[model samples]
Target chain A: MDKVKLGKEQLKELKYFIYSRGFREPEVMMEILDHFACKVEDKLTENPLLSLQDAIKEAHKEFGYNGFYSIKASLDVFTRRRYKRIYWQEVKKILLSPINLLILLLIGLCVYHSMKWAYNNGFYDSYFNRNIVSSLIILIVVCTELIKFIMLPRNNGRSYHISIANTVNYGNFFLFWFFFPSRKLHSVNEILVISIIAVLCSVYYYITTLAHYKMIKAAHKDYDDFKVLVENENPLQ
Target chain B: MEQNQFVKGSLATIILKLLEDNGRMYGYEMTKAVKDITANRMNITEAALYPALHKMVADGVLSATTELVDGRVRKYYSLTKKGKKETANKISALRDALESVQLILTPKIANG
Candidate 1:
C-alpha cells in the first residue's frame, strides 16, 4: 500500500498538538513532530477512513505512558552534551596544536616579563599596584562579555540548545580575583606560576569566545536553512 | 515470551547494524526495520528508540540531520566514522556474548 502523506495544514495541526503537549523547543519540536507525523501517516495508511484527529490520537498512543517527555529529555541531554563536546574539542585543538602551543608560550613569556618588570619596579609594594594585572584581566573579560551580550543573535525561533550554548559562564573567571598574587612578589617561581595562570586564563577566554561565535554563526545558518525549507513548502500559502 | 529486555540490551548494536546496512534512517523507519527483521516477534518501542538514538548521537557514535519529507521535517540518523568503527567492535562483542550465552544454554550431554 502506498503511504498516505499529510498535507501542510495537517502538519501544522500536528505541530500545534505537540506544542500543546509542551515540547516547545524548536529543535525538539521538529524531531517530535517528524516522528509523530510518521506514525500518523502510518495510521492513515492502515485505515484510510480515519480522520486526521483520530489518526493523531492513535499515533500519540504509540508513544506509550511516559509520552514525549522522555524523548524530549533525551534530546535535551544530547544537545547539552554535543555543545560541551564542541566546546572542549575546540579548546583541546587550540591547546594541543604545535603552533598554538608556541603562541601560548610566547604569551606566557610576555606575561612573565611584564610581571617581572612590575615587580622590579616595586609596583607590587602598593596595594593598588599589585592588583593591576588581575584588574586588567577582569576588565577585559567583563567588556568582552558585555559586547557578546549586546550582539546576541536576533533570531526568534532558535533552539534551546543554541541559547544554552551561547551563554558564557562568568563563574570560572571569579577565581582569577582570589588566586591573583596580592602581596609583593617573593621569588621568580611565583612570577612564573602567575604568568602560566594568566596564559591559561587568556587561552580559556580565547577558545570560549571562538566557540561562542562559531555556535552563533552555525545557528544563524541553521535558522536560514529551516526558513528556506518552510518557505519552499508554503510558497503560495 | 517477549524479549524486550534482551532487545533493549542490544538495541544500540541493532541500530548500528541497521544504519550500517541502510545508510540513513529516521526514528520510525528504524522501529519498523527492527520489527520487520524480527518477523514481528520483537518490537522497538518509541520510548526506547528515541532516547537510545539521541544518546548515541551525543556519544559521537551517530550523527543526525534533518530534511523536509512529506510536508514534515524528518530527522535522519547515520553513523559517523567513529560510529562505523564502533559498529564493528560492538557487533563482534555482541556476537561473542551471544555465543557465550548459547554455550551456557546448550546443556552438556554425557560423553558417549
Candidate 2:
C-alpha cells in the first residue's frame, strides 16, 4: 500500500475535530493531531481499501469512548498540580533565602511595632485606613495579573491554567469587600492582627507574580517549540 | 486494549530505553514502536503515554523538541543526561525483577 497524505484543508479539519473534542490547549492539540493523523494513515495503508475518512473514523474509535478527552482532562489536573508544587517549592526557597529571611523578619517586626506605635499615638481607628490600602493593593495586583493572563496570545502553553485560575479566583475579592465593609479595629492587638494579614498578602502577591512570569516564559518556550515544529513539517511555508 | 499493570510499572524505563535506542521519537511513534516490537500484544493508550512523557519532561528526565512533520507539530522526546543515567539504572533493576519473576513462573515438580 502506498503512503496516503492528508491535504491542508483536511489538516485544518482535523485540527477542528480535535478542538471540538475538548482540547483547548494548542500544545495538546498538536500532539493529538499528529497521533490521530498517523494512526489514520497507518490504518489506510494497511487496509488499502479503506477511505481516508473511514480510516480516521476507525482510528477515532480506537481511542475508545473517552479518547483524547480523557487525556486532556488528566493533563489539566496534572499540570495544575505540577504548577502548584513548583510554586510552593519556589516560595519555600524564596522565604529561606538570606535576603527574604531578613525581609520577612523586618516585615514582622515593623508590622507589629508599627501597630503599637499607632495605638500609642491614639490612632485606634486608623486600622480601617491601613486595611483600605492593603485591600486596594490586592485588587490592583489581581487586576494586573488578570489583564496579563487575558492579554496572552491564545494557545500559549499546556500548564498556564494555574496562573489563570489565580486570576479567576479573584472574583471572590469583590464578595469580600461587600461582606466585610464593617470589619473594624478597636485596639493595637487588632491592628497587629490586620498587619500580619497585610504582610502575608504582600508575600502572596510576590510569589504569584513570580509564578506568572515563570509560566509566561514556559508558555513561550513550548509555543516556540510548536511553531518551529509546524514550520519544519511544512517546508513549503 | 487493556494493558498489563506490569507494563505501566515499567513505563519510564521502557520510554527511556526507547529514546536511548531511537535517539528521539514523537508520541505516536513511541506507541507504534511498542506495538510493533511486541507484535501488537502491547498497546499504550494516549492517556497513559502523554502524561508519562509530560511527567518525564517536567522532571527534566526527558527533553522535548518539537518539529513540523506533514503540517503536524510533533513533539520528539529524547533522554537528558539524568535520563540516560536513570535508563541504565532502570534497565538493571528491570532485569533483576524479571529474573525473579521468571523463577516464580517456571514450573517444578510438586513432590520433593
Candidate 3:
C-alpha cells in the first residue's frame, strides 16, 4: 500500500503532543517525534478506515498504559548513562592513548623535577606557597570551562552530556584540593609524588575540555541537520 | 508451549540477528517483520521494541539514521560493526541455550 501521508495540521498536532509531554530537548524531541510519527502512520495503514486521530490513539496505546512517557523515561536514563560512558571513554583515551602518553610523561617529569627544584631552593619550605599554587591551578581549569559555557550561544544544543564531560575535568581537582593540607611534606619522595598528581589533574582537565568540545561540535551538526530538514519539509519557511 | 519469557529474554539477540539479515529496519517494520516471520505466533510489542532499539543505539550496538521516506521522517536502525560481532555471539549463545532447554523439554525413547 502507498503511504497514507499526514497533513501539515496533523504534523503540528503531533508536535504539540510531544512538546506537551515535556520532551523539549532538541535531540530527544527529534527522535521521539520521528519515532512516534512512524508508529502513528503504521496504525493508519493497518486500518484504512481509521482517522489520524484514531490511529494516533491506537499507537499511543501500543506504548501501554503509561503511554509514550515510558519511552521518554527510558530515554532519560539512557541519556545519562550514555554521557557517563562518553566521559570515561574520553578519559581513557587521554590516560592511555599513545599520542597522549608522551605528553603525559613530559608533564610528569616536569612536575617531579620542579618540585625537587623548589624544595632545594626553599620555595616549597612555605606551606602557604605550596597550597596556594595547587589551589590556583585547580581554580583556573574549572573557571575556563565555566567561562566557555557562558560564552557559547544560548542555542548551542547544549545537553547533559556536555556537563557530564566537564565533570570529568573536575574528577581529580577535589583530590588535590583536599589532599594538600594533609600531606606529609617532610620528604623528597612525598612532595615529588604530589607534584606528579598535580600534572595528572591538569591532564584530566584537558581530556574533559576536549570531550566537551566534541559534544558541542556534534550539537552544531544536529542543529544544522534539523534546520535543513525543516527547510526541506516546508519550503516557505 | 507459549514462550513469552523466552521471547522477551531473546529480544536483543532477535533484533540484532534480524538487522544482520535485513541490513536496516525501522520500528514499525521490525514489528511487522517479526509478525510475518513467526506467522503472527509471536508479537514484539512497541513498548518492548522501542526501548530495546534506543538502548542498542545508546550502547553503540546499533546505529540509527533518519531519512524522509513515505513523506515521513523514519528512523532506521542497523547493526554497527560492534553490533554485527555481538549478533554472532548472541546467536551462538542462544543456540546453546535452546539446545539445553530442548534436552529437558524432550528425550529420545531409547536412544533410537
Candidate 4:
C-alpha cells in the first residue's frame, strides 16, 4: 500500500472535525488528530474515490460505539495518575533534601520563638490569636486565588500539571479546621505545640507553592514545545 | 482470528516485549508491526492500544517522546529501565503459562 499525506487544508478541516467532537484541549486533540489522520489516510489510499468526509466517518466508526471520547476518558485517567505521581515526587523532594529539612527546622524555630515572645509580652489573648489565625487564612486564600488567576489562563486550561497544582492549592482549606479551635494557648507547652503544628502547615504550604511554581513552569515549557513542533511542521503558520 | 480475548489479558506484556525488541514505536506503527509480525492473526485496535500505552506511561514502565512527522506530531513510546526488567519477567511468565496451557490441553500419556 502506498503512503498518502493529507494537505494543509485537509489537515485543518480534520482538526476542526475533531474539535467539533468535543476535544477542547490541544494536547488531547493533537494525539487524536494524528490517529485520525493516519486512519483516514489509510482509508483514502485503499479507495481513491472515497470522499474525505466519508473516510473520516469510517475512521471515527473504527473507535467503536464509545467513539473517540473513550480515548479521552482513558487518557484522562492516566494523565491524572501521572500528575499525582509528579506532585508526590515534589513533596518527597521537599521532605528528603537535607537543606529543605534545615529550612523547615529553622522556620519551626522562628515561629516557636515568635509565639513564645507574644505569650510573654501580653499579646496571647484568645481574641487576638483568633484574629491572627483568621487573617492568615484570609491571606492564604487570597494568595492561592491570585496564583491560580496568574497561572491558569495562560495554559488555555490544557495542562494536567496546572490542574493538579490548582487542587494542591485548595488543600490549604484544611488549615481552617486545624487552627480554628486551638486559637488560645493555656501554657508554654501549648504554645510550643501550636507553633510546631503551625510551622509544619506552613512548610506544607511552602511545598505546594513551590510545586505550583514548578508545574506552571513545566506547563509553559509544554506549550512552548507544542508551538515549536507546530512551527516546524508548518513554518509559515 | 479471535485473538482479542487472549490479547486483552496480555496486551501490556506484548507491548513491553515489542518495545524491548524495537526500542521505540508510535501508536499506529505498533499496531501495524503487530499485524505484520502475526501475519494478521492478531489485531490491536486503536481504542485498546492508546489506553494501554498511556497506562504503561503512567505506571513508569514506559516514557513517551513526540516528533513531528509528515506535518503531525507523533508520540513515540519507549521502555524505561523498569520496563526492561518488567519485559523479562512478563515474557518468562507468559512462556510458563503457555506451556502450562499446552500441557493441560494435550496432557502427556502415562507409561504403561
* Candidate 1, pairs of clashing residues: none
Q: Write model 4 residue lDDT over A139-193, tens digit each, in one string.
A: 6766776767676636453564444544557657567445744355567677666
Residues A1-237 of candidate 3 have per-residue lDDT tens digits of 887667767777777777776765555655666667877877787788998877877777766677666666666666566666665677676777887778767766765666556555555324455644564565676687578768644453434344444454445456656655433366767777777777776665566666665555544565567555553423221
Two-way lDDT contest, 1 vs 3, winner: 1
| Local accuracy of candidate 2 as per-residue lDDT tens digits, B28-100 | 8899999999999988877778778888887889988766678776678999999999999999999999999
Model 2: CA > 4 A from native: A20-25, A96-110, A124-159, A166-201, A220-237, B1-3, B109-112
Worst window of 10 by summed lDDT in candidate 1 chain A:
A228-237
Candidate 1 Cα misplacement greater than 4 A, ranges: A122-130, A152-168, A181-200, A215-228, A232-237
Q: Specify the highest-TM-score model's number.
A: 4
Q: What digit string (tens of lDDT, one per residue) describes model 4 on residues B1-112? A: 3578799888999999989999999888888889999998898887788888998998889999989887788899999999999999999999999999898999689999
Ranking by TM-score: 4, 1, 3, 2
Clashes of each: 0, 3, 0, 0
Q: Score the docking of each candidate (DockQ).
A: 0.71, 0.53, 0.49, 0.74
Shift of residue A34 alpha carbon in model 1, Å: 1.5
lDDT of 1 by residue, A135-202 (tens): 66767877887887688675765443454544565464675666676777767788777766776777
| Model 1's DockQ score | 0.71
The predictions' CA RMSDs to the true structure, in order, are: 3.7, 4.7, 4.4, 3.4
Candidate structures ordered by DockQ, highest first: 4, 1, 2, 3
Q: Give the TM-score of candidate 1 (chain A).
A: 0.79
lDDT of 2 by residue, A38-135 (tens): 88878877888887667778889988778888667655666676666665666677767898777767765665465455545544334464344444
Cα distance off (Å), candidate 1, residue B69: 0.9
Q: Please state the Cα-based DockQ of model 2 relative to the true two-chain complex.
A: 0.53
What class would a CAPRI assessor give candidate 1's docking? medium
